[model samples]
Target: MSRCVLLRCAAAAAVVAATLVAAACGGDDTPTDVVLVTHDSFAVSKAVKQAFERESGLTLRILQGGDANEVLNRSLLTAGDPQGDVVFGIDDSVLSRAVGGDLLEEYRSPELSTVEPDFANPDPHVTPIDHGEVCLNVDRRWFASRHVPPPKTLADLILDRYRNLLVVENPATSSPGLAFLLATVATYGDPGWQTYWRGLRANGVRVVDGWEEAYTQQFSGASGSPGKRPIVVSYASSPAAEVIFASKPLATAPTAAVEEGCYRQVEYAGVLRGAHNEDGARKLIDFMLSERFQADVPGSMFVYPVRAGVPLPEAFAKHAIVPRDPLQLPAAQVDANRDRWVARWTEIVVR
Candidate 1:
């Protein structure tokens, strides 16, 4: 071929290649992607995330903060143009803030029928996924060896010889810590709860900023610690964690639950009003609420599914305890009174 003809052929080839690449890269306008923002405790296996990708035909991205309150607060402050398409793991403790910020779309999931009505809050903003009782966690062997009796009741923590040895997370930063605080208010009215905290403070309690630090740094034989405080705040299902994460199969968990003032905390999911893919976000929420997901929840997240009829594994069925009357102060009341209550609590303890 002559030089001029060869040069023309190369030029045509370059034009075709550019056209093909344009088509591959979305041609003119491709669908925008979305993100799901949640806390670290939130769990979903690779299979579930893949199913969402395949079914929704859009990429699923996750934006995680250290915990639900952190993610929720950030989302709330940026609601008009959120960083994620959906926000999850918010519970009654943070629902008021979420609602106050108008961060959620008015999404009434059709799957709500699968869950118990009480847990599903009648309002159409958020949907409950899983629930657990927040209770005192005790290392059974530690107490047994020391011959120091573990606290058996809310009152016991203040009066019993176990007083100074307790480790707790700060309510503003820890989910379970906040739930337990709410429980005290429910178990004893506001002023009475204040009185109780004053007593607890006098008894020499140690408070940390979050649950992970309190549990692992201060509590005895936690996941990565060599500490000695026998009592901590965690889910009642923590005993099963010992069996599941244990180095070997054991007869029973090394820990036991102190159930007297257990506070029930239920987690929820909501579609962000700014979602780039609204229907896809709704579908993901539906998938989370499905029976298959609920059944796996106990072992994966250490919580009971709110979806009715989902059977728990033998471990949860055998070990998880139900409080005679789990405490709950309605979300509305909690929101209305939290500032005053927390202030009063701080004055009694920190001052």
Candidate 2:
């Protein structure tokens, strides 16, 4: 294995994010200390953080690192001792494992009314915070230049002309990577996904470690120079992000999403089981699901708001689309099959 491959296989480090605590000012015991544990993708502006603090009287400290599974694993493995007051960014793919650890405190926020029932944590162990669409992304200019129509379906990718033009992140180490793998499972049931993957392997596919490398290193549109690969396994909103981050603003993005096989990934937030302050922790969870926080999701986390009626920013609103019939698998079922899926996927495609 190459050095990069070994790095991708290494166990993820524990991530810590956001701290809040109760601080005494004058005679009132104000809620001041609250710790938020999240992955590196989680983001919030200073103004938003200040709004949360003013609204709830809590000081925030964010500790962050690792993939979603490792974050949840570190939380579960040390459940007896515990770290941080709340945990966010556990997607449904790993939802079952987080629940299995019994490290979640139940606080069925009335906010469940605002979230889609399918994504709501029925056990009340966690609350869906936001969602993202895992879709195939293509470099519009690259394909247009080659006169090769961008693939509209996953199967279209196996055409001889398109060999090695697609890049996928390794599922074991990246959060979106896991979602993309689950998407295939949802689209092609049981052993069917393995068959589909074998066909792709015969066509020659490229796999990377994470979205950062896939998008920035491998995707032709974002590599700062032309890349050999044009398609990537990434969030649907990446095209818009590319436009926003470009050196010269383009009227339209150079990339687009193939929604046919897209997967819906719902991110969740919850109070860690051994939280020091249940009251403050519940308040934090509620805060995340509130309208103000939902409105902040797009720019804050580059994810769609879970709560209905939250208007998105122009950049995202213009390019991102929620796919119809986007693939979904039950969290419990995913938890049960995760290890098997990885083994089968690696067996078929990692050669």
Candidate 3:
């Protein structure tokens, strides 16, 4: 299947109401089922689910809460009285909010020893599962066809030649959008970041509500609905995904990531406070960090595993570009300034 088709199918699945699938018996009142609350983008193989069910003996129920911010907000609203036993896909940009809301119980996974120390945060309440770069993905054919060199850096997007050729999601609504916004903040610093956004706005940068629209609708590399914009704010792993999910085997990906100024987004999963199935939640977290799940991550969700020594799929090994100096902000700093920065971004870029 093509990337477009797969994404459409995933999106369809995300929109459907949450469902319950009962697991094997673990006695009457011991809570044999655990609910996992996550953003719409989460995906894993059936084998992984089966393994978890077979080993932990807990039925996994998933609740997809729109997007990352929406997931965080929903989890926050039900913090102590959580609707789900576990919460996943909370990225560094919003981790502090989850921490501040007191939504998670402090439980360190033993699997942490296997995770790369750089990806590990000091917080015991959350465990890193996967990480990916939010960067500019360019349709190589589009640029080559136009005889225009693809922009290599974030600042290059504002150049006159690249004007009206870029589409980005809204920082207020999307995780990658917020990560890109923070990238600018980290790249340019306070007032300078505001100036950079103004430049982008003046250069006719297109903004959408989410990644789905930006990648599937407005991106020129999309299968059927080809668009004018060649540069999109998307994951560094996206090109590898394109290669892996192509309708036919190809020599190379049609798209590639612009490495400079990319922002790293690390996703973490945690046991929710007051969960009915605390043991099950902790088991789920450990399972996420296990070699089986880590190996499944690249092809399944198109994100690099946090656990070291997990082999990358061939497509990822060849096509994905891990940024040498990806932009980053401390979780506390991001938490402190996220709202103000997003609001300022709206004032400068959206309004």
lDDT scores of the candidates, listed in order: 0.80, 0.81, 0.88
TM-score of 2: 0.89
Question: Which model scores highest in TM-score?
Answer: 3
lDDT of 3 by residue, 1-351 (tens): 999999999987765522222222243457788789998889989999999999988888888978878889888988899988899999899888899899999999988989997876558889999999999999999989889999998889889999899999999888889989999999999979999999999999999998989999999976554577999999999888888888899798899999998999989999999998899999999999999999999888898998989999999989898888888999999888889999989998867
Error of 3 at 166 (Å): 1.0
Pairs of residues at least 3 apart in sequence or in different chains that clash in candidate 3: none
Sort the candidates on TM-score, descending order: 3, 2, 1
**Model 3 per-residue lDDT at 26:** 46
Query: Could you list the CA RMSD of all candidates, in the order they appear?
Result: 6.5, 9.0, 9.6
Q: Which of 1 and 2 is ahead in TM-score?
A: 2
RMSD of 1: 6.5
lDDT of 1 by residue, 80-194 (tens): 6887777889888778888888898988888888897667654588888888899998988888888877778888888758767788878877788888889889988867888
Task: Give the candidate order by descending lDDT.
Answer: 3, 2, 1
TM-score of each candidate structure, all chains considered together: 0.88, 0.89, 0.91
What C-alpha lDDT, on a 0 to 100 scale, does residue 41 get in candidate 1? 82
Candidate with better lDDT, 1 vs 2: 2
lDDT computed for candidate 1: 0.80
